[model samples]
Target: MFIGRQHELIALQRMYDSKRFEMMVIYGRRRVGKTALIDHFLDGKTALYFTARQQNSRLILQSFAMAIAAYFNQPEVDFRSWDNAIDYLVSQARRHAGDKLVIVLDEFPYAAEAEPSLPSILQIAIDHGLKDTNTMLILSGSNQGFMESKVLGVHSPLYGRRTGQIKLQPFDCFDAARFVEHCTAEDAVRYYATFGGTPYYLAQLDPQLSYEQNVAMLCFDQAGLLYEEPMMMLREELKSPAIYDSILQAVSNGCNTPKIIADHIGLEPTSVSFYLKTLEELRLIERSIPFGEKPTSRKSRIHIKDPFFAYWYRFVAPNVTLIETGSGVEIARKTAESAVFATYVGQQFETMCMQWIFRAFRSGKLPLMPVLTGKWWGNNPLKREETDIDVVAAEPDEKKILLGECKWRNTVNETEMIASLRDRIGLIRGYRETTLAFFTKNPVHETTLAKYRNDPDMIFVCADDMFRER
Candidate 1:
């Protein structure tokens, strides 16, 4: 069942290929496949795998002793301290026939939190016990904050000790498509919008279920896995989960600007800024500006980085009480009737188009192009309003710009769509070398597609083309 972790497996092989003492730190949000990657890498190797618990130091030490004993087929080796247990492990690793042993400490942050001195202890073992032995030490954790502050931070005793670090991210749209075989391009895009590419969420989806049915089971079922998973996740990560939830809810509900979010949540802008920065650092939320500006000189807005959390805060959290007091099916029916999923999917579709546009530029699709990019508008002169362009390619020095539109509708009228693209090009200010791209739910018009079939300037990229290797 392992899919789409080619890079991580290759990295593990490289570490062993060195044949030196290796210390690796791997961390990411829960359900992002860190454990799965480690398990996949250690499939046939002589490895010791142990998960740390949130408990007292003595209890954790006992559990580690038991894990070590189990790893070596010794069921009853009693060790008083981690020092002794790791000493025995190093000895066992050296005695084994393999050139190197992989030792994985999954959720190492929890263990370090339970025993504040565990990292120093591991450092002791690494320096004195395992440096000469053929062993690779892998430490993994879910708490980005704790991992950074306690183990990886400069102030930590074991700082400057790790040889490598890996942050496991969700798979992109293509890898996710493998989970549901029969979905169309549009269906796959919608599924990614709702569930994201998190492996855990994709695994929960039933291939036989329709999109709406899967959403009902995921967010509205009484005993579903994801019904209250967000609450549990924040409770474990934050000191005050309620405040964190409030901040996320405000951002997810279209309160993006710092001042706007502060006003909506009734918190001072300064305090909200700190929380937003922490959330951004944790990769739970993001701060973005208009696409083409310098990182420092644009209006910043907050967004929930994880799609599942965004969906939960937008729909499920707002209606949790009704879902609890009334029937789950009734609430889900009302939620689906609101067309929220459609809007979310539309945004994801736009994102996919933009990614492909940038990719095409990188591959020399556009001749002498400075960048393939996007622009957001606080005020539009033609519409006399504000909006964002989904994709924008501009050569600022040449005063040239290209505008594009993305449509996730069931069907698109190609003649009308091309006319609209023509109109959009006319609205640009510093305009030159105008071009258009259309990302459609279905294919483009026959004559229109044939017209641009050989043109390099005007392009139509399908969703599958977005992730293709070429």
Candidate 2:
């Protein structure tokens, strides 16, 4: 079941329809559906696909030669070097002049790692011959650093040669809900909060089972597919898995600041900053400041960007010993009934509400468009304590802002919550008009609804409304 990515498919189709020389670079993290998108686009098209493996240069050259041979129906052909392989490709492009011929190198980094001179060789070929032919070239990889620095960076040999590029992202909350369409809207949110928007992970869920059953089978059981997924990904991507594991563990324990994380992991603050930067580059962690504050503010906080990783480190990593000792079912039951788990999901729900606001603004369903939107937290000097707003949005002129609160519980005190949100309005200045928004898991009471029904500035969005088609 292919769910979303209509935009990506349209982009690829536009390039293919041009019938001219083109090079598109596609890259993202592993299991992000890059290959799936390519395969779906290539259906019923004339193309030559080769997936590079971690092997010697000679073996990779031989494999490339075989694919070319098979594509052209000349099985007896062989190429001994990268130069010969590239030359043959250029010759074929010239022979099929004006005809669209796509050549995809999936996992191109593995081939480049084996033969360091491959990019320069390809660059020379592109300049000398391939540019005049109707050949569409695609280079895809999973290593974010290598793809950025070695393939797309300013100093790279292939820099300025690519006609297009795409950094594919995970699905948003609305698109991800399609995976379990039969489940309730609330259960769908919980599933998303657990498995996240990764297509590979979401495909493992069974909608027929309850949320607890699915969570236990896929996460807690020793023989489950995702039992050691985080550890395996770390080992594959990082040089020192143990140090990275310790760093992730520290961040998962609410050590959001550099000094606190360094203290938790027993590392120097400077060294910890380096690792945090790398994690940000890999899209595993994110760093942000208050919405209204400057980018260089000292109140910056770090968070785990991937929801599945956050859940794994918080629950599975801490209880691995007991899980492996055949107590996974009991532990899973306890985890489902724990207040900490509810709090964690509530935090995720706040993020989902922010996403819904952005989508609504794009579709013109809101009263005003926002130029800036994010969560806000700071010291309320009047109250002599720290305070935070779940969702904040400012208009282009900064004369109007939207302040919102998200509730992920069974019931809420509508009047009291509204009064508290009204009190925090004074914390922000320079806004002539303030719009109030509330997102809840359930509907508000009749009395509360009647109180605000005549007010145009009050916006009420419930879980069902969020799940509706935009």
Candidate 3:
């Protein structure tokens, strides 16, 4: 079943119904459901959908020719080249006489990879034939860099030909949780944290199976579906998977700074930066700075953006030899041991809280909207010390700042925590209004709750409220 992507569906359908010549480009990482989304839109329409494979140009052309024949309800037509394939579609569109004919060219970069001149051919088709008719050509690819630089960049022949583009990102925690069946909100959160909102990973989780069983089945055994996923993920988009894996593993294991990652990976900082930039473009990692810091700030740090990668690198990657040697049970047991996984989950829980807070601000559920939300950590000039705030939302023009803290601890001195947050708020100067918010995985302390019970400007969010409402 389709779990999410309502927004993308609506936008695509609106364009489909516009009754104009349109060329849409859709790109994302693999298994993000670009094909599925297109399928959903093409269900009731007269469409020709061809998925290009990792085959030679001749074979790809043959497959597309077969689709063209099937669409026109005629015998298979022999296509000479990619130019012929695209021109055949353009001819069909022109013959349709203003009636809408949707054409989906999935895995377009693969086709281009097989044939270097495919994009130029597409450009010609769009300019002379397809654009003049009521043809809706949707080019979709998993090669993000290729699609962006080769097809969408200004110097490319296909530049300015796309009517619109959809860069489909993975689902967020709340949206991803919808895919699980009969799971409680907390369990769903764990599921999202482990799968990192990828539909391909989430689909493998059985509703009947316990979480431990699913983790064991998917991640522990040598022959498990996700056991070798770390390499599999990088192999698709990168030349050498080992280096990227090492860098990602380093970040997962707390080597966040570029210098630290360089030291761990035995690469120089400049070399590490190139690798980090590639990973960042792939959306596998995050580089965060203080809320309003410029790009050159020394306070920047890298983080593993994908929860599954973090879990894999921290737990599975390091334990690969043991698992490969048929120690599945031992690996699972070791993974379940101690508070390490809990600490990781606590970090992911804070990220989800910030996401929820940003959503609330966007939907007018908050007291004031913010221009951007980020974590703040720098020298506190007023306090003459260093201070780190978990989450901060800034509205510079309005002089309003939202200071937030997340606690995943089972017990806490809530009064002192709030007091510390108040002090941090004082450190943040130039904001006329400041809102201090606290999020916790456990229940809010009764004393702290009673104190802020009457304060609207103060926000106290507990796990129960977040899970129940988000």
Candidate 4:
């Protein structure tokens, strides 16, 4: 079930084998697989794993004690308080002499919120107690703000104490594809664009169903997991869930300007700005001005950073009434009717292909080093100010650009797509060393395949190639 993250796994193993006290902090948005990764890596190891709750420290201590008793086969072990519980945990870790004891505190932010002094206490234990006891401590959470402030920030008591940290992210295109029971990389990209790389979301998908069908079941159905997921997620993470929902809807509808969103939600811009900052910190929303620019740039646009939230707000939440009253088939029909969704997902699909292009180029699977890669939007290539390449890769020094056109269709003729790529490049202002590459969900035309005939610069990649044909 573990796919990709070979690098992270290796790094984690190396840290564990360092023969000293170690601390790892892993945090990310909900369902990004932080806990899963830890669980997967430490499956059979001697580890004390506990999820923090919103209760008082005393209650949390009791829960931890219970877990320890269960794990150690001593149901009657008594711990009077949080401090005692932690002391015992450190003692047990020291007694386990072979390998280091792995202790994971999932949702540590919740515990810190419940007890402000928890971090100081943890720092004491890590510094005075566990330093030479061979313990690997992991603190993971979904509340990025709380985690940063209490544990990872410079002013925090626990800052600079962690040996390793991972901001667990969603699976990239290639990794997500591996979760597909039976689907092509093209299908996986579509899935990733909509549900995002969240393991929980991808795991819920039915491989036998098409993307639309899966959406119908999971989003349109009133009892589905995602039917009210946004609401639940916000309520869990923010104090003002309704206001946050309004702001999120505004962003999803393209009201990226601060004034526009505030006006739409009937809130003051300053107040809305506070919520926006929180969203940005949590990685739920992002402010972007094209790609490279200052954070306060005038053209900056606020957008939902997570694809699933974007898709839900744009498609499912907007049409909630219809979905609530309509049949499943009607919902699916309506979803399919939106061709614009394809264009949206197509752009993301194209980006994923670009990543593979860069990876292949880096690995020498393809010829040439692509120095610059991005989509040219307002800077159109055509004279009529229409038609831009879906993806472009260039070697600025060589004055060479590789033009690519992505087709998510069932079948693609490489020659025709490449021909279109050639035409699209005409609008690029500074074009130098030009190469041709095609990324298609469907197989390329046979004649075009024959024409390339092992050409280095002229290359084609299908959905299968993106996932290493696994």
* Candidate achieving the largest TM-score: 2
Worst 10 residues of 1 by lDDT: 370-379
Candidate 1 per-residue lDDT over residues 1-470, each given as its tens digit: 88888878888889987777888889888888898889888887777788988888888888888888787788777788777777788777668665777788999987888877778888877777677776889999998887887778999877887888898888766677678767766567777777777899899989898877887888887587889988888887878888888899998889988889889989999988888887887677887777556688557667887777887888788777777775677777666656666777777777567656665677787554745466554555676766566677778788767677788776777887777566565455666677777887776767887898997667786666554452
Taking the candidates one at a time, how many backbone clashes does each contain? 0, 0, 0, 4
Alpha-carbon lDDT, every model: 0.77, 0.88, 0.84, 0.78
How well does candidate 1 score on lDDT at residue 388?
A: 60
Clashing pairs in 3: none
Model 3: CA > 4 A from native? 97-99, 381-385, 445-447
Q: Give all candidate RMSDs, comma-separated.
A: 3.6, 1.6, 1.8, 3.4
Ranking by lDDT: 2, 3, 4, 1
- Tell me the TM-score of each prediction against the true structure: 0.87, 0.96, 0.95, 0.86
Cand. 3 TM to true fold? 0.95
2 against 4, candidate with superior TM-score: 2
Once fitted onto the true fold, the runs of candidate 2 whose alpha carbons sit more than 4 angstroms away are 97-99
**Residue-level lDDT tens digits of model 2 in 292-382:** 8888989999999888888899999999999999999888889988998888888889888988988989888777787888888887877
TM-score, structure 4 vs. true: 0.86
Model 4 C-alpha lDDT per residue in residues 1-470, reported as the tens digit of each score = 67677777887888788789999888887877887888888877767789988888778777888888877778756677667777877778778788877888999987888778778888888888898887888899988887777889999999989988888888767677777847756567778888887888888988788878888889888988888998998988789999999999998888988899999999999899899988888777877553223446686767787778888888888788887886755766666667877767775677688778877886787656777666544444344565556677777676777777788776565556676676665466566567777887766777777878777667777777677654
